[model samples]
Each structure stands twice: as structure tokens, then as C-alpha cells.
Target: MANASNLVIFDIAANNITGPVPNNFGSLRNLKWLNLGFNPLGVNQQPNDLGFINSLVNCTSLCYLNINGNGLTGDLPSSIVNLSITMTELHMYGNHIYGKIPSEIVKLVNMTVLELAYNFLTGSIPDSIGELPNLGKLDLGSNNISGAIPTSISNITQLVALNLESNMLQGSIPTGLLNISTLEVLSLGDNNLGGVITEEIVGNSSQCVFLYLNQNFFSGPLPSNIGRLKHLVQLNVSNNKLTGDIPATLGDCVMLEELYMQGNLFEGEIPLSLKSLKSLALLDLSNNNVSGSIPGFIKGFHLIKFLNLSHNTLEGEVPKDGLFSNMSAFSVLGNSLLCGGIQALDLPRCQVKISRNKRKTFSLRIILLLVLLPLGSLFVCLAFIFYQYRKSKKMNGSVAVLHDQQFPRLSYQDLLLATNEFSPGNLIGEGKYGSVYKGLLESPTRTVAVKVLNVEVRGASKSFLAECETLRNIRHRNLIKIMTACSSTDFKGNDFKALVFEFLINGSLDNWLHPGPYQENERNLTLLQRLDISIDIAMGVDYLHHHSHTSIIHCVIKPSNILLDEEFVARVSDIGLARFSFFNTSNINQAQSSSTGVRGTVGYVPPGNF
Candidate 1:
């Protein structure tokens, strides 16, 4: 093979070939194209496995070389700078190549396409990378590259696609990078990039078709002139610190197929102007401050596939057409005010409004009698109830207790210290009843999730008592383990109550399923993993329903209540709404009656419960 000096093209891609690449490629002096892609050419992990590239320098006519997906390791050699000056394309992505990209690579002035993505290469990207005048496509994504993206990249006049996503790049996006007239694909997601995206950045990228800016620290409103990108297809700015209302002008991007703006501080109603996005397939605006009614126009989005608007303050009747009719394709959870969706959503029925003119008017004397009679009776009943409550309080004292004697007790001060005085930074989640914080205990030397009940909220105290009673005796591998309970008064003498549970390292299943900004890149669950989680959840629910000493019903079972350990094992949590059922026939009917009324989260309630 070393004597084949006249070989102009050598192609051996996707053959699953193994072993080290031959180092005699220099013998093909006239070689113009070389492809050994998708082959296990260097699986032996030998040192200097890429020394073969040095021999390719002798092939003066080499114009293209592809060695991608070869499992090749070792530092990318600096000798690559000596490659033929005529080289136009170099592909070495999907390998184990490490070390810095040589700054001398600028010497390959004729290079047009440089694909070195999906490698272990670290260090800052070379600024001189912009000097490749003919370079049209530059992909350096999914690496450990750090430092700011070079503004010099804006000098590539003919640049087409620039992907720097899933790296550690910091600093704001260079304005010039968005100004390129010929640039189409601009992806810089999952980085440490910050700063407000200015109008000039969005306005200048008229030719851009794909724009990914998710999972960053970028703040401020999306530029209103973003509509200038008429050709934009997919726009993702999710999981950033961006605020302000989503721009109505965004509707002008009629070609948009996917729009993801979840996990931001975006507010206001879904824009009516968005009716123009007839091409939209996936739309996620969950975990934002967006409010107002779920628009009926969304039902007109016939091409929509997935729609998520959970955890927002949205209200009113949820439309039940098109995407909404498909329970698996859309989610409207956490918006407690939403109602009247498909039966599977189990939302409250929309109330019928009656016109004022249709009602009969009551006489003034009857109105006063009706109001004053109730007021007099309420005052008398309250006085009698207050006397009895005071008598009962005097007899029992103010001390709260868990019926079980096995669990240890914690004080308000102990919990306050463990959670750093309930610092906002330690807060991990919030619910209608309370806020959950991650805390570290000193005596036991363990981490725990501290759920502090907000006594001010109606039913909060009841929920706390219910949780303590439910978790006291129930023991299952798939059930969250309770560490202790706090039923003491704060320094202010106000009643304070909290429950401490063993912390799960991986957080809740909700994050794994519909990940927020920080969890976006790291919380991908595989199909097999999902199946395992489903089984774990089923076993937990089965134990609660049939296997426990007294059959218990976990009235509220949702993703946020399901915790995951480091090994991805699922644990059912938040049993505050649980109900116990005794085996006796008489008690069984009583248990069924006690479970009536609004028992669980609106969206997660079983259809029969409605």
C-alpha cells in the first residue's frame, strides 16, 4: 500500500474496520481525497495514534480528509499545520482527540469546512480560526472549550453555519457574529454566555434559519425586531434569565416550526399575533410567569405536536381541540386556575355565567333579613366555638406531636440552622402548601429536604399533620424516607412546623421529564430508564393501595412528587394528601367518604374524582 503513490482518492468509510491507521499515506503523493470515517481505526489507544497525519503532509494535492468517528485518541498534533496548502476540508469530529486547537491552523488559508466537534479538546478556541477566509462551516460543539467566543469570527464574510453549543464558552455573544449576511445556522446554547441580546443582533440575522440560545445566563427581553428573521425555522431561548413579555412581532416569523421559551421570566398572555405561526410543531412556554387565559387560537394549530404551559399563572377554560384534545401531546399542569380541558386532564368544569338581567330582584327588607340573620347566628356560633377551643387548648397545651414514638423530634432553631435560616438560595421547590429547601444537618452529618409549612395558607397545617401521620409507619423501598419532624415555635413565638426527609441527589422526576434551565443538558432520560422509573412508581403505588398493613391511597401522585436517587431509582414523595383505609367494611365506607371533595392537584386528579 505504501507503493501506491498514484492513488488520487482513497475511501473506506463505515466499514467498522479496526486497528491503527497505516502511516504510509504520504506515498500517495497525488491523493486529493481520503476518507476513513465511522471506522474503529485507533481503538488500541496507542500513543501518538494520529502520527499518521504527519505522513499525509507529503500528499501535496490533498484537498479533503475525513477521519471522523474513529475512536482515535491522543493530542491533535501541531504537525497538522504542515498539511498541504491546497487542503479545503478537514473532518476529525466524534473522536477522543484532546488538547488545544493549534493557532497555527490559520495557515490553512484555503480550508472551507472545519468539523472538529464532539471531541475532548479543551482550552480556548484559537482567535485566528476566523482567518480561514474560505471556511464556510465551523462546528466545535460538545467539547470542553472555554473562554469567550472570538469577535474575529465575524470577519468570515461567507461563513454559513457556526455551532459552538454544549461547551464552556463564556461572555456575551459577539454582535458581529449575528451580523453576517450569509450566516444561516447560529447555535451557542448550553454555555456560560450572558448579557442582553440586543436588537441589532436579532435584526441583522435575516438569513438565519436555526437559532439556539437556551441554557445560558442571557437576560433582558428578546429583541422585538426578531421578526426580521423571516426565514427562521426553529428558535430556542429557553432556560435563560430573560425577562419581559414575549414580543408580539415574533409572530411575523411565519416559517417558525419550533419555539421554546420555557424557564424564563417571561410574562403577559400568549400573543394573539402568534396566530400567524401556522408552521409551529412544538411550543413550550412552561415554568414562566406567563398569565391570562389559555388562548382558544392554540386549538387552531393543527400541526402542533407538543405544547407545554405548566407552572405558569395561566387561568380560564383550557381549549379542548386539536393539540389540547390529545392528552399525551400537551400539558397545562401547575396552572391551578386552568379548567375545562379534555377529560384526561381532570380539570375543573368551566362555571356557567348568568346574565344580570335574567335574575329576580329581592325586596330590600328580605335582603337585610337574609344578611343580618346570618351575621347574628355566625357571631353566636363563633363565641361558643371560641370558648370550647380555649378550653381544649388549655387542656392539651400547644405542643404538637406525631403519634408514633419511634421518630426523633427537631426544633425550629435546629431546622433554621440546617437550612441557613431558610435562605432563598437553598430553596429547591415551592408548592401550594409550603416551600422545600435543601439543608445539611451537623449532628447526623446528612443532607435533607426541609419542607416548611406555610401555616398562613388554608389547609397547610392539616397537610402537615396528614404528611406526618402518613409517613410515620409506611415503609417501602420506593417510598421517600422521612428523617424527623419539627413541630416547635420560632424565635418570634409564632408556630413553626417543618418535615425533614432524606435528600435525593438527582432531584425530582419532574426535572428529569420536563427539565428546567439548569437541568436541560443533564437530565435526558433514555427509553429503558423511563421504563424502569415507571415500574418503580407502579410498585410504590401498589404498596400504598394494596400491600400496606392498612391500605392507603396516595391522593396526589405526580412527577414533582416523585424523587430520583443518584442511580435513577424513583421514590414516591409528598404523601400529605394520603388517606388510610381500614379493612373493616364499616371503616371502608368512612374512608371512601373522607376522600371526597377536591383531594389532589387539579390537573393530576383522576377523572372519576371530578
Candidate 2:
């Protein structure tokens, strides 16, 4: 073991070496380079021998020291100057070092590979870091280092890899550092740097491999010069505020592997130049306004594994290539005109068929030029026309019957005759959205119900068609059935309208739960009934949320929107202000599109409005 003194250095990094870093390492006298990084040594490569590592100072000749891979712990000695004056390759990565890195570290002038990354190092990185003239690879990533990246870091012209990612660093990205010609690996992602990503994000990208700027606050158009990084394997700039068209120059990155540009404000069509990326495996450009048909020629690319173009203004036939062959939830949503991908979405298709009679007549014209056949064909055509006309009239009658069907709906005169002309005795309830009146439908069939929206309001041209469309789409037992709408001109030739609805004997659950004395029977609701009502409401909300592919938030949730049926089933109603979380706001100007904004009744808006 005495021969260990002659051993100047020991290294076992980037290997499968295991167990504790031998405490006997302290005995090495002439040790100049002791490297054990990238190796699976010690407990999870952590070591108890770290406490004795300070004793290495006895080996005054030690210069190129590397105790990186094995688990070393505790604070760096505050007085490390005397032991590392000639140190050039000081690698202590994958360690448990804590407390602020002493400012005295700047004294190591000859340091080349100073790797203290993946440690418990905290506090601001010393500005003196830029003083190391020979620092080729300065890795302090996955730490709690805060403060601006010192501008002086640009002075290290020989630096090849400067990784300070996943730190607490803030402030605009230092433009000067990007000017360095030799830096090939620069990762500063997941920080508080907010601003436009300037052109000099990484100056010499000829050798750059991976550049991840995802989940940052960078705004403005994506740089057109991104093509300069010909060797960039993975470029993820997703979840930013970058606007405008994706630069065509990105096609210059022929060696690109995965391109993630989702969740940005990028507009315009998907660039055809993107097809030039031969090696790309994943391409995500969702949540944007890239309109136009998905390229049919995408089938040519067989290497694509994941392609997400959802929540965009894209329309027409979805591409049936690569990942599209299988029904994937990751593909296609928020596109209004997209159709014909799978049976999951019941898309309609038009069918055209040639009639046998027409075909036979055309054949007869070529073979037998007979007058009898021509006369018979004319009669048949006339008969077909009459039959079609009658069928159309019947369908129109059915629609009309459906239209005037709601309690056969009431006019100002019908309600006046039923209620003796708005007497206070006929009033049922009154609230914001209008008043309600209890009236009976007379004649062959008579039913009792409330009349709402007074004669003046009802006399206007009402959009009952749209209201009926929205109402019939929902099916809840608690909601009153919209029987039909009545539309006609009043005595002054002005439009007067009303919608007749089936009235529940017990009325709204709101009056029941709130207990008004005039209708005192509401307090009779049992605990079981209340529980059943709560369950029904929750189920309704759940259906609006998960059962459908997209989740919907019932923004105006309150007691008034809840109604009780004759069976005491709690029915949630009035989804007038429900908001979809993933809806795109920019498309609101488009006709018949979704709304994504501050919505809901006055009392229920969350902190972040839309």
C-alpha cells in the first residue's frame, strides 16, 4: 500500500465503477490528477469518505483533482486557495456540496474543466467565474445559482460547453456570452429570462447540438436565422409568446430531430419547407392559427412518430399518414371544418346515386326511338315531381307543428284572456331576466304554466330558433320542457313572440332550498333528496367536463340555475355561460366559432379571466 504514494492521480468516471470512494485516497502524496466522475461509485455513487476529503491538502502537489462522480457531501472549505493553486481540471460534479461557493474559487487561474454541477450549491455565482482564462467547460447546472450570468463570461473564448440550466438565474440573457465562437453546448433553459430572443442567442452554433428554450417568457417573432444551426438535433422553443410565421429558414436545419413549437402565437400556414427535415421524429405545432389543409403528401414521411396540430384554424381532410393511421387523442381538436378521419366522430358524407329510370330512358333513346316510351317517361317524371312536392309540404307541416307546439305558445291576447289582463293575482315570480306569470292554455288541450318576458318584450322579433336549438341540445329532467315557440305580428303589424314551456308543479329548486314562506312546502325536502340533487348536479358537470373529449367549466354555478322535477330529481340548468378552457380566443371574430374570454355570471369568475 506504500506504493499508493507514487500514484499521482486516479480516475474512474463515465464508467460502472461501484462502492465507496476509498478513504485511503487521502494517502496519495504526489497525486496531481484524481478523477472519479461519471462512475457509479459509493451509495448511489455518494460516499462517507467525503468528510476526510479536506485532508487531501497534505498532497501539496495535487493540481488536476477530480472528485466528481462519487457522492461527496458538506460545505466546500472556505480556505481552498492554498490547496488548489495549480489546479486545472477540478471536477466535483454529482456531489452533495452545500453553502455558497467561496468567492476565492477565482484564484484557480489554470482551471480548465471546473464542473461543480448537479450539486447542492446555492447563492449567487461569483462574477469572478469569468476570470478563468482556460475554462473550456464550466458546468454549474441543476443548482440553485441565482443572479445574472456575469457578462465577463464572454471573455472565455475557448469555452466549449457552458451549461447553467435549471437554476434561479434571472435578468435578460447576456448577449455578450453568445458572441463566443467556441461554445458548442449552451443550455440556459427554464429560467426567469423574459424578453425577445435576440439573434445572438448562441453566436457560433455550427457545433451546437441541443438548445432547449422551452417554457420561457420569450416574446416576438421566431428568428428566421434559426437555419444556421445545421447541427441542432433537438430545438424546443414551445410554450412561449413567439408570434408570426415559422421561419422558412428552419428547413436549413437538415439534421433536426425533434421540433416542438406548440403553445405559441405563430400564425400562417404550415411551411412546406418543413418537409426538408428528413430526420425529424416529433413535430408539435398545436395551439396556433396555422390554417389550410394538412398536407396530403405527409404520407411520404414514414419516420414521423408524433405529430400534434390540434387547436388551430386548420380545416379540410386530416392527413392520413404516419401517426394518423391509428386513432390518437393527441391529434385534431378545435377545427370546425375538419372531417373524415375515423368513426369516433360521426362525420356526415353526401351520397349520390343514378336513378334506374333515367338510365333506362337514356338506353332506350340510343336503341329504340319509340314515341310511346317517351310519353310514358314524361308522365313518370310528372308523377315524381308531384310526389316530391307533397313530401316537401308534409315535412314543412311537421316543422310548423314543432314550431307552434310549446303549450301551443301564447300571444298577448291568449294570456290576457287566461289571466284577465295582467292582474296581480296572476303573477308567479319576478327576477332579473324578466317576470313570470301563471297562465292556463285554453281549448282542446289545456295545461298550467308560468308566462315570462312581459307582452312588450315578447312583442319583439325573438330569436327563439337559436334558443330552441341550444335548449334541445341539453337533456335534464329538472329543466322545463320547451314545448314550442309562437311567432306572429301584433295589432300594429310588429313582431310578437313567446316560447311555451312545460311548468313543474313544484317550481325551481332555488325557491325550495331558499324557502320562501308563500310556498312553504319546500322545507319538506329530506336529506336523501338533497344528496340525490347534489349527485345529479355533480354528474351533469362531469358530463360537461370529462364525458365529452373537452372539459367545460360551468362558470355561472349557483342555486338559481338548479331546478327540481316532480320526482325530486335535482336538475342543473342554465348553461348560458359555460366556458371551454382550451378554446382559442382569436377565432371569436370568425362566425359561429367558440368563445374564449372572461365569461359567466357576476359572482363566479376565477382570478385569471380567460
RMSD of every candidate to native, in Å, equals: 23.5, 23.7
Q: What's model 2's TM-score? A: 0.52
Highest lDDT scorer: 1
Clashing pairs in 1: none
Candidate 1: segments with Cα more than 4 A from true spot: 358-610
User: Each candidate: how many clashes?
Assistant: 0, 9
Query: Model 1, range 1-610, lDDT digits (tens) per residue?
Result: 7678788999999999996988989989899999999998888988778999999999999999999999898899988999999999999999989999999999899999999999998999999998998889999999999999999999999999999999999999888888898899999999999999998667576779999999999999999999999778999999999999989999988789999999999999999999878789999999999999987789878889999999999999988877788898888889999889889999999898756544434355578888899899999999999999974664344455463566666788888899999999999999888899999988878899999989898877777766766777789989999887777789988978888899999999888888777653766898758966886898798778766766877777999999999899999997877666766523544565222233788888655444
Candidate 2 steric clashes: 9
Question: Candidate 2, overall lDDT?
Answer: 0.67
Q: Candidate 2, which segments miss by more than 4 Å at Cα?
A: 1-3, 11-27, 36-49, 79-82, 202-204, 326-330, 334-336, 342-610
**Residue range 129-206, candidate 2, lDDT tens digits:** 888888999888888888877888888888888888878887767777766766667777777666887778655556
- Clashing residue pairs in candidate 2 (N, C-alpha, C atoms within 3 angstroms): 8-31, 11-35, 13-37, 14-38, 19-42, 45-71, 46-71, 406-483, 406-484
